[model samples]
Target: MYGTAAHNTYAQNNVGIESPTRLIEMLYEGVLRFNAQAKKSIKDGDIEKKVYWINRSIAIITELLITLDKTQGDISLYLEGLYNYEITLLTNASVDGDVAKIDEVSNVFKGLLEAWRESTNVA
Candidate 1:
């Protein structure tokens, strides 16, 4: 546990060591978090905040795709393909107002993150 924490701390300190897979996983998690916040904001009657999270979620997916392409030529390409599918799902979820899709994406990303952490020895 300490080792994992230490590795996470190390990764936080050194962004250079972050892989595309890690970035995509982080973005996936962020989408869930931000969307939840957006939902709350909507419930609280704040249209702006709702839009904020929606836009943020979209931005994260967009950036993930671009970053994946830029980070190409390693294990990144495979990861990119996986995320591309996730991104498509996310896009559909956004359009269809399907909260369940987010959960599905979250599950898929959790698996991806686990594999990435094991292979890279990252936390």
Candidate 2:
């Protein structure tokens, strides 16, 4: 409980202090980190941890999907499809214990993270 509270506080602080672009980059980084954990959990035969991490990744993706500005036109539409595909891959990986599926999602996010950093000049 203390750990979670501390982590939440840290995240809240970041939200308050960080630029919006940096926050999005952090979210992408988070998904990749969670995907790595989920993949490791599958390899270790730890079903509970696998599901937990995969669910975390899915939640982040869902948040990103929902927060997208559809008013941006084609980019938002493209991202909606891409994020949905990532969520589907994460869900399937959770059920099938397929590390490759996790890898697929990770690959996408890594590219997105780099692109985000470059485009946003975040860092």
Candidate 3:
């Protein structure tokens, strides 16, 4: 009975069960979803929604960078000013309701994600 109850709790929480690759994949998918929503919001002429998703995407990217830095030892230099560039783009896109900057940063992240996945054998 104890074993069965423990298993039930584990299943409920799904903690300590997910693979790291799965975690990264989920983050990637979330960022992609945010970008898609941003595009849709732009098409619908909703500046607020666009900004919302763009901000969300930037937040995710920031988290990813943090994770990478923790695991990889100061990769901010490898990014080579890209982080600042993305922040500027994010700021401009949020202020101007323009999606071009957001898309550019999203593409940059997509490339980074792909490269990281490949290097980590998670792809």
- Which of the two, 1 or 3, has more lDDT? 3
Q: Give TM per candidate.
A: 0.56, 0.95, 0.69
Over 4 Å off in model 1, which ranges?
1-28, 38-51, 69-75
- Scored by Cα lDDT, where does model 2 land? 0.94
Q: After superposition, how far is residue 26 of candidate 2 from its true place, in Å?
A: 0.5
- Candidate of highest TM-score: 2
Q: Which lDDT tens digits does candidate 3 get at residues 13-117? A: 773677877666667666778888987898899988888888887786676666665445456566635765776787787777777876887787788788878
Clashes of each: 0, 0, 0
Global Cα lDDT for candidate 3: 0.75
**Model 2 lDDT per residue over 11-104, tens place:** 7987999877888998999999999999899999999999999999999999999999999999999999999999998898999999999999
Considering every candidate listed, which one attains the maximal lDDT?
2
User: Which tens-of-lDDT digit does each residue in 1-123 have in candidate 1?
Assistant: 999999988878765676666665676677768767756765677766656776787677667667665455766777677667777766675555566765677677667667767777776
Consecutive 10-residue window with the lowest summed lDDT within model 1: 93-102
Pairing residues by index, what is the TM-score of model 3? 0.69
| Full-model lDDT for every candidate | 0.69, 0.94, 0.75
Residue-level error in angstroms, candidate 2, position 75: 0.5
